[model samples]
Target chain A: MTEEAPAPEPRPAPGLPPGPFAGPAPAAAPRQHLIVVRVRLPAHLRTLVQLEKETERGPGHGTASGPGHGTGSEVTLELDSPGTQSSLLDALETRYPVLIGTIRDPRTRVRRPFIRFFACEEDLSHEPPDSDLPAPVLAGTEPFVILGAMAGG
Target chain B: MSTIRVLVGTRKGAFILNADASRKSWEVNGPFFGGWEIYHVNASPVDPSRLYASQSNGWFGQLVQRSDDGGTTWQPVGNQFPYAGVPGTHQWYDGTPHPWEFARVWHLEPSLSDPDTVYAGVEDAALFRSSDAGTTWEEVSGLRRHDSGSSWQPGAGGMCLHTIVLDPVDPERIYTAISAAGVFRSDDAGTTWKPVNRGLSSESIPAPEAEVGHCVHRIAMHPSRPDVLFMQKHWDVMRTDDCGESWREVSGDLPSDFGFTIDVHAHEPETIYVVPIKSDSEHYPPDGRLRVYRSRTGGDEWEALSDGLPQRDCYVNVLRDAMAVDSLDPCGIYFGTTGGQVYASANAGDSWAPIVRDLPAVLSVEVQTLP
Candidate 1:
């Protein structure tokens, strides 16, 4: 028996969209009104976010003068409003769930042994959870840095 | 086709290795909680997809993670392990009274029937149970309040309740072993407890024949025969056929019996395994050979299996809770070493191979046989 010739490949109809050939459109960034809050994580804690990077700046910081832009060692967190230390942490944990208990206790909500907090070059680690952050930090001009204290000789 | 998942908890993180029934060509995945000490990882018996992991560090203290989708994603649940009421004191390492304290969990025993129910054995030698799927833990204070608790002292390790074995035959009965406090059994579903160290003796204690104060490293039991139990004590391999009523030395023909982990074959109730370290102080294998001694007749008679294992320059120690068995056709045996090797024996310990050569000093291993 004579072998049948292979059928010719079909092309998309003129009026129809490119169904299988079209790749998905780039995901539109979330449109919530975001507040930029800079954060600095310790070297050890850096391993937690080793695989993922929050390189995308939210709508709030379209300008290059965003908080932590000049500081080479800071990461920015997006929040709905100017937040306190705990609120900033809430935003951070929401973004990176793995860091839930690394910076604070899962139960007591106490700061971990070697984890310290700094804002405007002042130690704000022991401040009350609801206390308003420094004006520069609140204005997204200075990063709220998470410092891993010097441990072990 | 059968699938086997070997869950390994190490000093630095956790790893999961999967393979088919042929026991060849494995796939390894892990370091789930990287940079943290993963003391134990166990899956729910009723629902294999659900898992509980004990994650802790010196800096962060302790946290419990739950993964409903096997281990792809994990969520932090409640980490509060509060004593029921009026937390009392137990004897410290210095033989002085010390207040009770909450420490990291050493073992998590999921219920045999309910995926939401679990038991956590923690340091300071206390037992806590969670009926809400590990969301919150309530101490089964009867164990900490047992009369002998005050006399219980910490071993070189802290006074940690590291072994928890639930009786499949009786829902009300539970068994837990502590580092230096011996074994305690509760017949009232953790409402109350009593020490079960009747035939156990240790020269390290003042009263070697006393009710408590035996460093019980690990205990195992075949689900089919819940009344029969096997234990690896500080310096002896023990077996108790009548539950914990009495025990006898089964350390017979092994090179050394001062080992940390002991487990029973999943399919054969009479087959058992132990890695005999030189001694309690010297935690290496005898003669620098890593040999796993298996006793087909339950105990006493033993044979060393080292086909694919290191027979020289092997100085790694296997910690308690570091060995487990899978319920496959020939019965698969798996264990991890302090030197970071996870060995697997698919044919009842007749031969062996390492599923992973370098993990972070494995602390625990558990196997789940999937359909």
Candidate 2:
């Protein structure tokens, strides 16, 4: 029985993509365009984000010049044209690196607990992660915010 | 009497829900007790007018509030717990602040012997007794002794004392259930504790024993017989006739023994209600079905109520403490789920009607007929 059989490992086609051995090409760059980002922080995190001061202190804090708190907490992002979801989240994270891991994954893009996103004044809580946010929210000109989700009980 | 009030505890605060008989129109007065995470919201059983709300502020400590006018106003009950004032705090309960200031309370039971005698279980896996109402409190020193430092544990949420059963005839013969830790008894009012977990299921890694860490989610007693218990354990629903000395699995016919709350008839000892959700690994309604089952012969047979339950794919998981049966003659059964829907069964569990929906995920459901 020992001398009867020695199986050979299967081989892939020469050039027609090495089948199982071939690596999937990196995901194509997400379709991009222009949009706005908004975050709604609970009271404690709003203070953590200096949202009150950002609102009261005016656009001076909007520029990325210093790091005193939320002073450097702006998000830069890419979008799928004006008034879209992907674009809004992209702009928010690009401007705020600290928010990268705090909200969506730096790699996976999943929303984190205590962190929430809203668009067009409607709570888009259970929407598909990659779905377009909303037409009104991605105007790129309106004031958008990023904030934490506060849950209890 | 003119309004039905529903108390909601949120991450930031609590909300007071006011509704009329229809239970349809709702007015939400929310974000109450700002910045304090309300864990348990309860109304005095004898007088629905008086309200009790417990809050946990993590590092800051735990706080409780009392309302005299149906949650229209509030006052804080924080300084009652003195353990937070000490230095060497013995064994840390739930691996957290031993007698945490902000330690959450899972059960707020008012003594049947005296309305003022309140039993509260906190994060430290300890039970507290307030003899003279909420004015002052003393730790159940006796039960704490039996905690068995190494074996005691908390649930996924945390180490918690979530269930407190106060005997109407004799408050001294009280029972308390802690998550991760099994059920404990204090026949002499929290002075001494012992293992009342006989017959209960605890299939944790290694093996099961009388020590602790059995993972009992909730336990209920026949309103008249304090010794008789129905518990929604980690894996099964069980019963103990001789006051936790011996047990039997009542959920044998159930597709899954996993559930959060179990309600016994306020008067009839044989009738009980159990809402069986799948176990933690397959956490969903049983068989992916939206059913609230009732066992008329003490869990021997079950009948699912779907008269008003949604036919849609409704798989809302309910918290253990969120479902209850009131003491009304036929008994009033009410339950709330994580998906923000509340159901009421006017005539026991024969049929159920959805009264409130589209609200915030409900944490607790406490109901009392009009005074």
Colliding pairs, model 1 = none
- lDDT by residue for model 2 (B203-254), tens: 6634675556688888888867777888888888888888888878888677
Candidates' DockQ values?
Answer: 0.10, 0.03
- lDDT tens digits, residue span B92-132, model 1: 87878998877689999999999999999998789988999
Clashes (candidate 2):
30
TM-scores, in order shown?
A: 0.82, 0.66
Q: How do the residues A1-153 of candidate 2 rate in per-residue lDDT, one tens digit apiece?
A: 001112222222112211121111124424454333433333443432344435553431343222222333343334444333444566554654323344554434656433445434444544665555443334333223444443233
Q: What is the C-alpha lDDT of each candidate?
A: 0.81, 0.61
**lDDT assessment of candidate 2:** 0.61
TM-score per model (chain B): 0.99, 0.86
lDDT of 2 at A47: 34
What would the TM-score be for candidate 1 when compared with the true structure? Answer: 0.82
